[model samples]
Target chain A: MDLHLSERHLRFRDELRAWLEKNVVRPWREELRDPTASEDSLIELRRAWQKKLHAGGYLGLDWPKEWGGRGATAVEKSIFEAELVRADAPPILNFLGLSLLGPALIHHGSEEQRRRFIPPMLSADEIWCQGFSEPGAGSDLASLKTAARLEGDEFVVNGQKVWTTYGPWADWIFVLARTDAKNRYGGISFILVELRTPGVTVRPLRQITGESEFGEVFFEDARVPRANLVGQIGEGWKIAMTVLAYERGATALAYSTRYSRDLAALAHACREVGRTGPAVREKLARLVVENEVMRANGVRMLANLADGKIPGPEASMEKLFWSEFDKRFRDTAIDLLGPGGLLLRSCSEARPEVDWAREFLWSRAETIFSGSSEVQRNILAKRALSLPQEG
Target chain B: MRFELSDDQRLLRDSARDFLAAEFPLEETQRVVEHDPRGFDPAAWARLGEMGYLGLTLPAEVGGQQLGAVELAIVLEEMGRACVPGPYLDVALAAALLAAAGGRERLLAEIASGKAIVTIARQDAAFAGEAPCGIETANGKLRGRKYFVPFAAEAQALLVTTPGGVYRTDAPFAVTPLPTLDPTQRFARVDFDHVAERMAAADVVAGLEPLAAAAAAAMLLGVMSRAFEITLDYVKTRQAFGRPIGSFQALQHRLADALLRVESTRSAVYRAAWCLDNADPDAALAAASAKAYAGDAARLVCGESIQMHGGIGFTWELGLHFFLKRAKTLESHYGSTEVQLERALAAAGL
Candidate 1:
């Protein structure tokens, strides 16, 4: 069982590392700690970074080469993520478009749709937000009440999508709206609606972290062209399921890298504060052990991917692990850091290494979003374990 | 980069599993635990040596297969699944220490041929929170006591640890059995008064801790996984409230969490074994992490197996308690989770 990177993969990593070293002028932490940086300015910074990555031919890393990709394997994609974390580079502004919508359109969208959408999506000219979750249809996404009726040349849509991450700045929303009201799963249609359409509205919602990173989108009889529909009318659920599967890439490596950096920072902070007692040291050591295990898990996942193994229901285990561990790590950081840990990033007394307060609050949303911990557990029980369904 | 066992390793695992299943089923283990003074069947122990299981990691010069840690982990994991009764890990480690000291070829051959039994006697205390190194050398003879020496009553010789070095002490008298949660395990406190010959420096066995931790964690992985599987099967067939109890969301979610721990332990155990086999830079930290993680994971999975089984789980006749008890013993020994945590921290330079 070999875990060493192949020569080709090593070359890919070295080249990417060199590119990052040359291009990244300011690490993301420095940008976030800038007192004058506003939300819009930070987003512009990320957009600029995305453009740089696209120019470097690093975007859509594992996608087919015909669509501006490097035609890399999953191992390369995992290494790209880990390198980004190690460099502390700013996250791309159009991640939803690149990760979710790009795969969906490449696989299920009509040729015309791909031609119109893929380029701008890669270039960060048009940002995308998911319109799948709503106030009434979160864990039970198929129960969505969003309706879309076909008119002469357009589909009239009416829906309210909540927890719309990036909706505040996105130019488009790919929605799952009901076209046949009687059928639960098959009636759903995947439609892309412009944010500036006549009756569409986007209102930012303040999160517990005191940021408007996500918002709610309202659709009041918005007319989207029939050409915006992806695939057949009744195939939205199938397409959406496949799109979610794309999110299950080897993310553990990136998560562990980022966490390790923050953990080292926390350890330094503890030393600076002279909190090196046995109890505190034990807590820090446990976190260290846990993070190392997470790294092992990530390495195993990458090795399996390289071994030509398809990820199955075990992806839920990864999701549950990182998300839950985030909460524990953040909670321990706050406990060890004392009251100073709760200070906002703008506060002068706050730790500059990590936005501890923001992460502490943001970790709450991680378990709730994507797929909630409960949903992941259900997936493991029903799919992986093959347990009997509830009567 | 591949994470799976190679073809030869897979063959070893399959053969080990088949042999252990046939020769050391839970019923036979139960019989040994109940009546065998040696804590293992003599015939079965001889079979293991004949099958080359005893010398899995020893060099060919000593009549061994000269395999690596991954192969040892595979065999030990299967033994754990079968709840095989013996001092397999103890004897293998003792033999390795002797091999590393660069002498005693005859004893090594005897060990590989199942003609003799030897195990390390290292523990200096009978309980936690006590000062260590009570055992020392005096008058060219080993003195003081060593606690938790595996199979001390049955071992023909004991490699006793002293303040200065490790000494080979032949055994004839003075062994007090210290039985606890696991009946299949035979630990003892040995009053070492025999004339001793210093075998090697104290640090000669420095490399053994990680190997021991990784191998023990592999055994824990097997124990928890088998317990989980047994519980899963039980819930699928056992009825409650007019339907299978596994259908309830409460049981389902808990079982899901249990599965998470079991699988995570598997990943950690194999990764540690691989790192050690390859002599990778991360070997120490990976082995420590695997042991620490597996200790807690085995506790949860084995405890949940009993909880899910309701009443029969607690009964001795059902044999679930044996797994739970064995898991506890494995957790506290072979470098306990607390010790591994500290080792991991040092390895990571935290």
Candidate 2:
């Protein structure tokens, strides 16, 4: 029940903080602050920073040591994340691979698969995209229509995956397809396909932020090796659940920490600009509180995971809070910025826009992605509350 | 770091649930609502006291079980499920205030023995703008009005905070019972006109804020659980056009949304309670957030519970009104959702 971090954990936090201070260069910070930074520059800066993290043994702290990770404890991983955020490190393009697919592979992949995939993922030499969410199967994932048919030693896949973050640059994709359509959940199977497959195509969808960070990936007759299948055949739903847990739990921490830092920066920026209005102050204050609560909720969830307690329905609770809080904080930042918030960094007369406008637009997806708030609520009702499930 | 409840706490929760189900059912709640100063059965209070539930949060030295806030929240959820109306919230809050105020040996002892029903009047006219300070000392007397004092009509002693200090208003003070939205919980407007008082120098108001918010959050947790249950029952039984109403995606989505609110609110409330027991610095903000979130959730769930029930749910005879009244009343008590947001902002130094 105690919220204070242990002395050893505090020391670990200090060490990480010091390391980040030395190695985390400020180019990404400048890029994040300067909305004028070109998209290519931002992408390149993120990849280069991820390489620095790999060299520093901080990129995949929770992964096995054989996979080039530090093999750190949950506490250490949490500390690394907090420190990385406080240092304002660049976003990790390999997050989908390292946090989601890597863990899933470690638990469910073949030995050869692990040996081939883990190291490259840790080094950011390969970026991965998730293909669990199809155009039809969102919250009701068991109802997916994506088909993968076995043909000799390989499988031919055909489906459309929407909201594929960084799908355009991904070297590979981990997808779930219906291999046995009669069994519903049991009919599914997970497989990894190289993005360079002949029939694979990615079309980036422009976001409200004017950046196509996500894309709609279509697979038609995409051939993947049988060895790429994870776990047993027709066990894709089980594998997907494991990946979803890792994705939801890990990203909850990352997103909350990032938003907390963003809120702090916004507060400091407001103070520097001599924004004294009560509305501005009030909005800033609420964001601070929301950010703090989100942090605490993240800590509690991590604690549960560290203690070997399955996150269960409560993980969705954290997800719900994090997504909602992220939206609220970003919106509040935009409101506080007022007229200047609408101005882009390219506008010379703009009051140092600080990317708050871009961030606000991005935050709208918080509820839509990672299981819409509505879906999370349904999970909460049926699982956590033990309410009767409706047809 | 562990977020799961301890085995003892889980057992405590289960036993509390069983006790409420077997002893103080909704019928008892209805009876209390029909007759009683605080709109609760005194015999049921005695039964709970005998079960050692009254002093669940107090120290053992004061005839209590010395359980933590998590346990208190668990008990509160069960109480809310049964819709058991009483001065339980007021008593728990008073014990917390007395413990925080320090040097209240006699008062705590009396409270533990169930001989004294103590309540804190937080919403006083003078300290309405500040952190609920309401005790005053001038010519050896205390005079002020405490608004919306829960169970003031039945409370044996009142803990009043003022700018000068906190004071005990024992007797001879005017207590006027006010008609409230929730008949299950009674309220009164107390006017202290030069009442005899004992000054409590400790800043109990600040200490009591977190606990009060936690208790309110706990009550809302109960409200949500029952509302969720009622909604589920209605959706399962009530038929629409050749199907159950719950079969409709529109209603299912709304129910799911309501369920999300309830569960998240539960998490926030219990986490806040845990923090309060552990003395976390962020406890105040957490509690406020929980209160605001849970209060809103309870109101929404209760409103939807009635709506989802269709015509029967809207009737006064249907028992939905009991929960609806309590949920709506609790939304503004302790602190309004806006007040909590403001407190949270202030706590965050916004």
Candidate 3:
């Protein structure tokens, strides 16, 4: 009945906005803009920024207070995210760990495991990477070939994981490895493997965006302590599903604000295109309407989440819808950009290189990652709609 | 912030659904669509009048429940689901304008009681938003021909739009039904010759134009939702290729895509409705977005619903095509998606 944020939440947003505005510095801004800037320094500054956010009690807004979170309401978290986007702050360096692994651990990990992982992730002291997809296993993650064998008190892991975001920077990875190869899905186990262990080699891959934000991780006889196992050895499918559930939950829900900003910027860019044909105008106009819908839909999704049910098919549906929208949005932005679209990096203020070209390339990855649109549709068909699979 | 309906709102919506389900079954709706001259069952209008739903948004002084646009939207959604045949939207819109323009309290009560039918002959369809071309006015009397007047035969009170402003008349005027893509609603052309009525300087209808657009879109929301449910039901039960057609991935994905539009349309309409209730500055653009998206989405969902249903859907008895017709009607009722998109773009200062 009400979509307006409460006074308390608005106050929280204002406070957070003030803190972010005061803390995010000019140097960090320049570092993000300057392509030649050193990556390590940017990472360090971002890590420090996460720690600063933590020190300000801004981290883990939705986690229960007993587990070091503010126990914030879903609305507050939604507002917090909106504020973060509004400030144009650098993306939290330990994003995957904080949003994905931390929530999964909080829900499925042991008390000791939670204590061991949650704090470091909160402080950005330990970066985490996901090792679910492999070269051969993508949409069909159940067919993953990674194997982990228990030897004495350790599990020796050997596998190659592709599209591993933060692989080079991660200190640990919660990987889905086959423990019971005989049972395709039931055999998989969710194992927390440290990247520092011997045989763990992280190779960064150059992306279409020409940045190494993600990499291919090679694990050969990587030793993981038995204590690192989250839940049962053969129950990783359920645990991995939980991780995916989180991926499609608040983190997925939070993309709308950033999308709204991107859309606004694109609308601004769209006006600069001279002699725009009717086709272009129609596309631009459609994008505007869709952008508004995305914002509204995100609010609806958050409301559903607030009702205290782990989002089900709706999340997957959103995952399918928004990622597709993200790509089309960037494509339209480029189409309107004309000659400027071809520039690998746009430095012109009228059309920022990073915002347009780099973004268009990055948008290509949206559909490929986080359960591709095809996979999402399949999930909707099989799980949500209870339809039979074609095998 | 709560985005879902409240318990009270849900009750309002459910009651409307229950009433529509019982009073206006597909058979009855078909009769209304095909045979009824007024394009709706008279008894059903009386039933809604008894329930005080006709005056849902009218003020207390005017015998209305004083509920906001959200209630109207919820009721309209159920109307679409039931395929309720009537000039309900035209009536609701006319009530809104009359409430704002004032000096129509008695008429508002009649509308609230379903004792009177009123419709806004605004700029819509062939001459939508166009200032009247040959409108002749002298001594507070009007004479002109109005195009695409909704429910002209049924309405006892008509708020006709002209270049000067809005004028009201209950005096006699010639009414001629015209061919329309949609059979569930009636449209007519009215020729006016010295129909004695006073003109009023009213911007209320102009102010509520976006909301009027949004209301039309809300109807599409219901139409698509029901269409989806019907198609889904058919796909689940109707066997093809030795199994339920829904089991096919192509069909399943197509249905899912349709569901996505349906879901997004629901969101867009609700948000647009919410903007109206809260008086958000972005109301105009939000309404345009709601109208534009819902029209296109419903067409896709309704058309695909028929395609998925196959031969049975193509038949007249199936009544699936009514959704397509109704969606097509509402799509161009206030304005086509392209027209609304331009309105939105202009509102956004593009």
Candidate 4:
């Protein structure tokens, strides 16, 4: 089977590259790297950048034009991501809403919900956070104890969502709450709530990276309009599943592209340093091969998704490999850099503060955040290997 | 772009599965492993020949089916599933090498008819120096010792790789059987002492190295896939804690990972095979990655399959040992994981 892109796709890629080169500038890059940048500044910059993308018809390229998208093919989407990484543009702050929740709402949400949410998401008028993981329910998400009770025309929600990235800045949150507690999966419902609602509190949690990029969102008697409920009653579990599929499915593209670029840069830097020995070179080569494998796997996954394949449990393999590889690659970069790699972003002597050190620290959560590597291994064992299940 | 198997490939797989099941069942394999010249049934080889599998991927002009690598891979996978006791991989690789070398019309014809057993001898322990330590060629005479040559005792023609080039020998070369981890795929140590033979090609050594590695990778894919299926079947029916173990999340996740590894390696091996067939520039890299990934995956899955099966898996009577042995042997056959990694790195220009 041919792995090369078609002529038309190549042309499209060139066009996208040209566009990104012209549009994506150093200001956006500078804004993203500014660790002490105010949350409002980051939010404003993200909104402005997203608005520019929308105006340029790049945002929501995979969605229908009627829904404020260019309706581009998956290949085009991959090209866009690759070019975006190459351009070193600002990171998308509304990834949860744009990639995961927005897609789920498009598929499972009511017509009104779609009309209300999709446009705002595309325009960056609204930012969203996922309310899936809880204290006791991370990988075992169905065991979530969040509750939402129907009351007249609204639902009173009360629950705590931990590890909610950018929760403090989100304008809305799509939550999976237990509406019918008798059945685990069947009892759940997906609903959207405005973050400005009364009794809703968001407390930013300090991470090991010393950044408050994520937060704990607590809802106490918070009211959500009944119209915000996605799909049928007690169908939140299905909606959540759909969102998770999108999340896991989209992972191969974004993660691989970013890491591939990072890997290339790291290799260049190591060569420039000229102090890396044969062992370091061998380690670097291994990471390169792993990166290539991940890229191939990612391309295959994307092709399968484009062909309407659900990817099912195989996504776990991609997740496991990508996260683990990220950590290892970053660690290898650090080791190769030696003392120079230890320099923090705030340190003047730090060898290009944005190089391997920041990456090493950031990669700490790669496995832990997106369902720990342990959980991923469990998925691979049970779903892929068909092994005898442990009691 | 098209990864799906063709109709011919599908039929090849089905027919291979049916033939192996009927002719070379596990009982027959056990018998062959216990008391055959090379631990493979001759009758089974004849049956495979009669079914046109011997020359499944050879050209029609060469007295063969002329199918593609995908079809060959399908058949190989079935053989793996059955844990079929034969020298299929060795013969197939020899045929491919002969085809690439371009002057072996007679041998190819004989192999297509399943009348000849051939294997490539390329594994040299000493990889450095002007010439490898295992095999040497000087003035058309080949000498040196070849280690762990699969089915070497039973091979009618030995395809020996030397620093000078690849040479084919039908004459009596010293062959000593070596006790191997996987008896089903028997091995032997051979000492070629100035054996007179025709040098196949000047660049045959360089050209055939990757092909042999790719074939070994494909064979391992077959083994791992079958082992996974067997493990899955056992896990499904074998009860633990009052329910089928397959129902448990822990086992399911592990099995899923195994399936992913197997499937990914399957894809990689097939891609490598395709690269060989098409003579793609990326053939070497693809072959290296395929071998490296498949070797690791096979070892891991095989070990886990035994662990998941509990006591029965570790027993010889249960037959899990057969595949485990084969997996371990295959991992070190073409190239060790470390060697493959080095090759992969060089191929990637790292």
Ranking by TM-score: 1, 3, 4, 2
lDDT of 3 by residue, A1-391 (tens): 7877668767887898789889876534356667665778788878988998898898888788876788887666667766777777777888878777777788888999998889888989999888989999998889999999999999999889998888878898889999887999889998998887899988998887777978898989988899999988898999767765654455434677676666666666666656367787788788878877777788777666665655688877777777888788888787877777766543544365235777777877888787788877887777766776554
3 or 4, which is superior by TM-score? 3
Q: Would you list the C-alpha lDDT of every candidate in the order shown?
A: 0.90, 0.76, 0.81, 0.77
Query: For each candidate, what TM-score against the reference?
Result: 0.99, 0.88, 0.94, 0.89
What is candidate 4's local distance difference test score? Answer: 0.77
lDDT string for model 4 (A71-157, tens) is 776667767776777677777767788887777877887788888788888888899988889988997888999899999999999
By lDDT, is 1 or 3 better? Answer: 1
TM-score (second chain) of model 2: 0.93
Candidate 2, A1-391: lDDT as tens digits: 4455667778878888888888876735577667667777777778888888888777767777877777676667766766667677787878889887888888899999998998888777898988877778787878888789999999999988877888888889888889997999899998898989999998897888777988888989988889999998998999878776654455436656677566667877787778867777666665655565566567677766667665677677777777777777777776776777777656666555257666678778888887888888777666654544554
Error of 4 at B259 (Å): 2.6
Off by over 4 Å in 2: A1-14, A34-37, A70-79, A131-163, A175-192, A196-203, A216-238, A268-296, A348-354, A377-391, B126-136
Q: In model 2, state the lDDT of residue B302.
A: 89
**Candidate 1 vs 2: which has more lDDT:** 1
Model 1 C-alpha lDDT per residue in residues A125-241, reported as the tens digit of each score? 999999999999999999999899999989999989999898999999999999999999999999999999999999998999889989899999999999999999989999999
Note the DockQ of each predicted structure.
0.83, 0.31, 0.63, 0.31
Worst 10 residues of 3 chain B by lDDT: B123-132
What TM-score does prediction 4 earn? 0.89
Checking candidate 3 for backbone clashes, the offending pairs are A346-A353, B123-B128, B123-B129, B124-B128
- The interface RMSD values of the models, given in order, are 0.9, 3.4, 1.8, 3.4
**Maximum-lDDT candidate:** 1
